[model samples]
Target: MAQGSSSPGDDAGNLDKTFREWQDDGSSEVATLGGVYGGANGVNHMVLNVRDMEKSHDFWTRVMRLEHCGTQGGPGQPRFLRFYRSHGHTHHDIALSPAKDPDSLPIPTGPLQTPGLNHFAWTYPDLETWKQQVRHVVDTGYPIQFRMEHGMSQSLYVRDPDGTVVEMMYEFPEERWNENIEAALEYRRVLDIDNDPDYFDPKPEDMPLFDENGLAEAS
Candidate 1:
């Protein structure tokens, strides 16, 4: 009959045509049958609770060098501070809210060897930019915990005013990621104080006199 069309006895031909059309649609109906939601497409934003809204805002904007969106609050009410990276156009990357008792959250006293939120990592374009941030952290006297090679990424960890750990990282090439992640996990598992030794112990020399941009003089 017509090219690629089904005839009365051509059931196999019709099935092949139907299967091809399904494949062309790009989404797999059969694969989605398990009801699994896909991974996140990207990071939208994150919110954090802090004790002093003003202090937290200053730390993020002045020290961390994030762009301050604004502050919102009324008399006798808790305040909220919104911030985003200079390159970000969305609402905000982070929001800080005032909590009643800030000190209640237990600060991580020892090295990060256990399972939990280790830190939130942000990527940098290159090593130079990362080192500039390192210099800023050193100058500002921010409590830097460690500088580490995670195989997939090189990272620096620091604690914010509210005791939240933040990470700055430069991701390695895509092909190396899986091996790096595996290596990082193994490193964490086998880490020992006497064996590997700690690289980042906060000291007076490690503290920076300026903020991240190396502009503002720390007080």
Candidate 2:
């Protein structure tokens, strides 16, 4: 533990041995940490800026199939906001309004649309049900930016009307990544939209273990 001394940080043999032991033990032998539950429940609603409300409505309603609850600016309400799933799914799953000077903003062009915000994910009940939505996107002629098999979920990176990357995905069971979440997070595999309808077909194994900073060497 002394300075300039041989330590785990300056060592590779110990780390490699542990990693190999993990691989030999199979996926079930993962380490986990129990956490204290806070009073927080979960994400209830969100509001975002859109280029066009009608176009956004088409994308969210038709593609995502979110139910439109109602909008503000009716009679007493002075706000012009379109609300989706105001109560059932959550207090308000999403609310949209037009963006101010949208043309002046930098266009979202990244695979995951990284400019202001990267992406936001919506969960599907299961993989099969999610696949149906993927097919719907294809049939609707929407472009799928990226298909990924993440350690915790299989996801489709897609564009909303404003070109924001909206991720539709379903998470794998806890047993898949309950242990060693960091290593599990590093597990990523590209999936084909056509051939890999169900990315979990073969299932992923041999998750890569990166150092805390994801350095090439175990620095």
Candidate 3:
């Protein structure tokens, strides 16, 4: 196993053995290229270059619910800000940098629309918190992209001032976590709300798993 790899059968002693074998296979060379493994194991924070630092900062802290955690510099240095969730151990969960000119950024091209970061997800502790998040989005009059229930999680997608998608969600009850994986694969479901305006009023519900014909009953 790699340093951060996981397997269903992994256990204390077995995991140590796996890591030793993996390290001896010449695969760990690149990871330890700069003295030690620098390969990403999990998300730490995401920094975005935005049109206006103050605007992005306000949106992230006030509306998106991240707390202003720390600051640097007095005036001349590059403007930067760090934010973290109140209950999280990480010093910062999100950061921002000012872009000299956001309008001059090149537009993506082609039918496939090229490649870019589509969205990032933030999880709520539970369903009640998820509902509060939905209400806050509605209260702020933010543009909602859609709502989805993936059996494992319930989500709300909203657009920020910069038109970047932000996904807010909460994991479904633990009882539903063990649902049949085959059912999910066979009958995928999603709520199409691109046109409906009242989609955010009531809380969303998980749609039934797809049927043999690949369709779910309308709520």
Candidate 4:
């Protein structure tokens, strides 16, 4: 009998034969260009469920440095808080919803034994912007768990009121994106900028080759 076979003559009995049938079906396509051909433009917005809407709103707008755009619902009812005042003109970049259960735990309610959304990252345009972010967090007295150079980017992690991790990152120079791609595919290892002292403040010569046309030119 086949290892996985329910019956001796069943096609599903042989794993190898079942795999071959899937490959020969010719119902799938792979992109030779190796990128999202028609993917989403970017992350539009995110919603977080919290025990106290007022507290979450204050943390997001003041501590996290986002703008309080507008909101729906009313006090003592199901309230929603919106933040987009400074970030962009979008209706809301991030929003908060108060937990319906008044007695729900203030901390994350997800399973403690299993891995879940470790964190979500937001990127800044350049080092200066990132530095400004650092200043804001410091001034607000928001807790900073860690700050480090992650090879391809510099990052700071902060915990919100509900103990959710939010990562603030500044991407490395775009000219080096090709180098990042090559390193990721070939060595399958993250570039550790922390190991290099100069990574903190690069010189002109250390800059990666970049043309206005973009990666194709640098490559």
Ranking by lDDT: 2, 3, 4, 1
lDDT by residue for model 4 over 1-219, one digit each (tens)?
Answer: 112344545532354654454457653543111132222256788887777777787888787778777777766675655445436646777777776784765565343344666678888877778768866886777777766554356667777787788888777765455545654223212223347444334333343443333323222
Measured by TM-score, the strongest candidate is: 2
- The parts of candidate 2 lying over 4 Å away from their true place are 1-39, 74-78, 111-115, 195-219
Candidate 1, residues 126-188: lDDT per residue as tens digits? 666766766677678777776765534556777877667888765655544343344433332
* Ten residues in sequence with the least summed lDDT for candidate 4: 31-40
Model 1 residue runs over 4 Å out of place are 1-39, 103-106, 111-116, 178-181, 184-219
Q: Give all candidates' CA lDDT scores.
A: 0.57, 0.66, 0.62, 0.60
The sequence of per-residue lDDT tens digits that candidate 3 reaches over residues 1-219 is 245344433443355555566678867344321223443356777877677667777788767888888776533476655555645576887777666778997533222244778788888887677778787876887666778766556678766556667788776554443445455444423565656443453344433434344434534
- Flag regions of model 3 displaced more than 4 Å: 1-41, 74-76, 86-88, 106-112, 178-219
Q: Model 2 compared with the native: what TM-score?
A: 0.68
Whose lDDT is greatest here? 2
Task: Give all candidate RMSDs, comma-separated.
Answer: 14.1, 13.0, 6.7, 11.4
How far residue 180's Cα lies from its native spot in candidate 3, in Å, is 4.1
User: What TM-score should be assigned to candidate 1?
Assistant: 0.60
lDDT of 4 at 113: 44
TM-score: the better of candidates 1 and 4? 4
- Pairs that clash in candidate 1: 138-207, 138-208, 139-208, 139-209, 139-210, 140-208, 141-208
Compute the lDDT of residue 103 as modeled in candidate 2. 82
